[model samples]
Structure formats: C-alpha cells, structure tokens
Target: MLYDYPEYYETAFSFRNIEEESRFLTKCINRFSKIDVKNVFEIACGNAPHAGLLQEMGYSYHGLDINRNMLDYAAYLWKDLPNKVNLHEASMVDFKYPIKQDFAYVMLGSLYLNDFDEIVSHFNSMSNLLNSGGLYFLDWCIQFGDPLAHNNNNRFVIEKDGIEVESEFNIKLLDQEQQMYEEVWTIKINDRGRRKQFNMVERNKAILPDQFLRFIKERDDFEFIGWWKDWNLDNPIEDENNVTRPIALIRKR
Candidate 1:
C-alpha cells in the first residue's frame, strides 16, 4: 500500500492507520488477564503510531526502533497525550530494558534477515526478557517454494506535493543451496526535475513452514501457541507465500 512512501510513513502507519492500529493492539492487550498488563513493549516500533493506540487502551507501553529520525517523529506526535509513551532508538539485537514485560510484540517481518543462525540467536535472546508464561507475538514472511528458484520484481510509485518517489523491487538469486534469496530495493525521490535515489535491500536466508516449526521446537523456553498465515482474525489457515504474512504467537513455559 502506501507503506513504502517515506512521507506517509513519517506521519502515520499504512493501510489500517491509527484507528485500526488501536483495535489491533487492544485485541492483543485483552488476551491477558487485566491484572497482568501494566507494562507492554513493542520491538521495532517504527514511528510508534501504535503507542497512541496503546495509550487509549490504558497501557503505559514502550516503543523501540533502530532509527533516530523515526523516534523523534514519534516523540513529537505523542507529546500532548496525557499518558507518556516511551520511545527507544536501539537495535533489537541488543536492547535491554530495566523492567521485564508480561508480553512483547515484534510486528511485520522485522525479525527476518539474511543470516539463519543469527536469526535463531536473536530469538533465543528474547527469552530472558519474558516473564514466566509471557507471550511474544511475531510476524514474518513465508516462502512457499524455493525463494532462490523464482524471481519476482515489482515497482511502487508515490507522488506528493510535486515530489515523485519510486521504489523498485528487484529480486536477485543468491544461493539456492540453503534457499537463500535477496531482493534489492532502489527508491528514487524526484522533485522539480531533480532526483535522488536510495538503494536498500534485504537478503533473507529463506525458511519454509516445516523448517520454522522444527526450529521453534528446539527452543526450550518458548512454546508455540498459534500461527496465523493471514492477518485475518477469523480464519487462520492459508498456504505459504499466498498468505499476507504469518503471525506467530509464542508463550514462555
């Protein structure tokens, strides 16, 4: 959708916007008993549009993102709210808060990266932050087939105030031995006949559904609770790659 647009993302979240973000967070909050949810933490919180949403639900939640610019924007937006939402600019790989949380969330495919070993290491690290039987909600992209075997490319263009921003997604085959795949993204921001483009990409060492299940099984502290292939709250069943993305619900045992 308009999520790729830097301008739109600078102000608010994409698609569901603030209202839908509120509803989603509220649903997550309700999952636990009312006595257990005084503090909430969200990793890779982006602009923290969801912070305002959490505040409305009576949670004094904290948001963390790696980017300083996005954190500044979040602080500015939530300055007037009655309940203060904390924002931290730090990498999820090494973030440690003073207080342990009853539940944590890392939205979208933010945790997936090029390194399979590192991904598991990162997941293992989160276990220490969780309370007994604490929940960790994660969402990730699922590769149905061999990701390196297929090439998919798409382009998204957005125009705002005479400025045209174009994001081109180009898939490059890396290593098929481990189903490794990389997509290079080039974003061109043009205005008044002048243009500047930013090139960024994610190289994911792909893991299929079965592989993910096996990996989770090896973890001693977390138990697989539920998996939703699509974001739909009602129907949780769908094939890989065909689904929007998967939301993984885990509990510490």
Candidate 2:
C-alpha cells in the first residue's frame, strides 16, 4: 500500500499547504480551546508532516499510527528538532497515553470506525486521553451532502520532485440501516522509471449531520460545539448546502 511507503505517501499528498493548515490549527486553539493548550496529538498521524511545524510553534507534538515506517520517517525528518515528536503505535479507535493531550485533531476524513459501538469507543478513548476542556477538531468526517455522490472528480494525479501519484476513490453503500459505506482507494505511482500500485479497501460508518449531533448529545463526556465549511468559522453549516470541507469541533465535558 502507499501507506507502507512514507516517501511516496507524502509525495502523493504534497498538494496540501502545510503552513496554511498549521495556521488554521493555531487559530482553532486560540479561538475555541477552553484550556491552556500546551501540547497536541494527531490521530492516525501518518508521517506526521506537521510535527516540525508544531514544534517550531512552541507546542509539544505527539502522534499515533499503526505503521512503523511512517513513524520512523516522521522521526527521521524531525530528528534534529529541539523537542522530539513522540509517536505511539496503535489504532485510532482505542488507545491510552501516559501524558494527556490538550488538543486533538484528525485530518482528511480519516476516522475509520465502522459502527456506532466503535464510534462510542473512539470517543471514550478520546475522553480518557484529553482534559476536561480539551477540543477535538474533526475534518470531513461527516457525510453532510448526498453520501452516494461519489462519481464526480474522484480521480486525481499529484506529482512532486520526480514522483507521480495517480489516485482514485470510490464509495459504495454497504448497509443502509446502519449507514455504512465501503471505500476503495487505488493508487498508481511512478518514481522516475519504476511503476507501482496499491489498493486499500475499508468499511466506515457514515456519520451524518443529524446522527453526529444526536450521538454527541447522548454522550456525557462531550458537547457539540459546531461545524463549519471551508475551515471558516463564519461559514457555519446549517443545512448542509455548501458542505465543502466540513469541520466539526466538540469539547470534553
């Protein structure tokens, strides 16, 4: 899989503006966090592209990922930094940390839990690892618009520094009763003259807007803050019309 190759994986997602994302995270912390933020953690942090940036911004960085190669690559990239990024080898659904994080975030719709039980467990795990006033920033984890709209512009090619990556994504309804979907991602890569391909298929629970709010309401440890579109707090999502890059925030109670 592309995730096995950290270099190729980072190259494939090189289109993201790391500086802009870091700035957004800073703004989120400054604007929403109810605690004195000291450190942060990234869920499913592959290669932890933001470790260096977070360290430079004066926040201790920690990450959790199941891939050892990704963690090692992240460490090697920031090995010279004054504050080292500590990475834990674990799954996103359940894990514990010796040091609790003041702020937590997951990017690019990577919350892979496939059922209500898993979702509850994930939040329970998060509650255990965060302080009372900590915030969790979730990006694109909810299916706001039509969940079946998977046919348009699902393919893209990204090239950086002699490496080319072509990626295609497809989503299929798995179970309508529980709102589950199966996602298949195919990646074809070319490094100079060599060619490689990887495919990843996974089942994820489709968390809808109403379902998310209801779930948050049922939980005793968390309270829904709000959701926005395009990373702008002023663009609050009311009815899911302009659901471009939807992000939600919830605070630990």
What are the root-mean-square deviations of the candidates from the true structure over C-alphas?
3.7, 1.1
C-alpha RMSD of candidate 1: 3.7
lDDT of 1 by residue, 3-65 (tens): 233354542223345676467555655663233676778887877767876777777878877
In terms of lDDT, the best-performing candidate is: 2
Candidate 1 residues lying further than 4 Å off, grouped into runs, are 1-13, 16-18, 29-35, 141-153, 159-164, 190-194, 238-241
Which stretches of model 2 miss by more than 4 angstroms? none
lDDT of 2 by residue, 47-84 (tens): 99888888889899999988888888888888999977
Q: Please tell me which predicted candidate would have the highest TM-score against the true structure.
A: 2
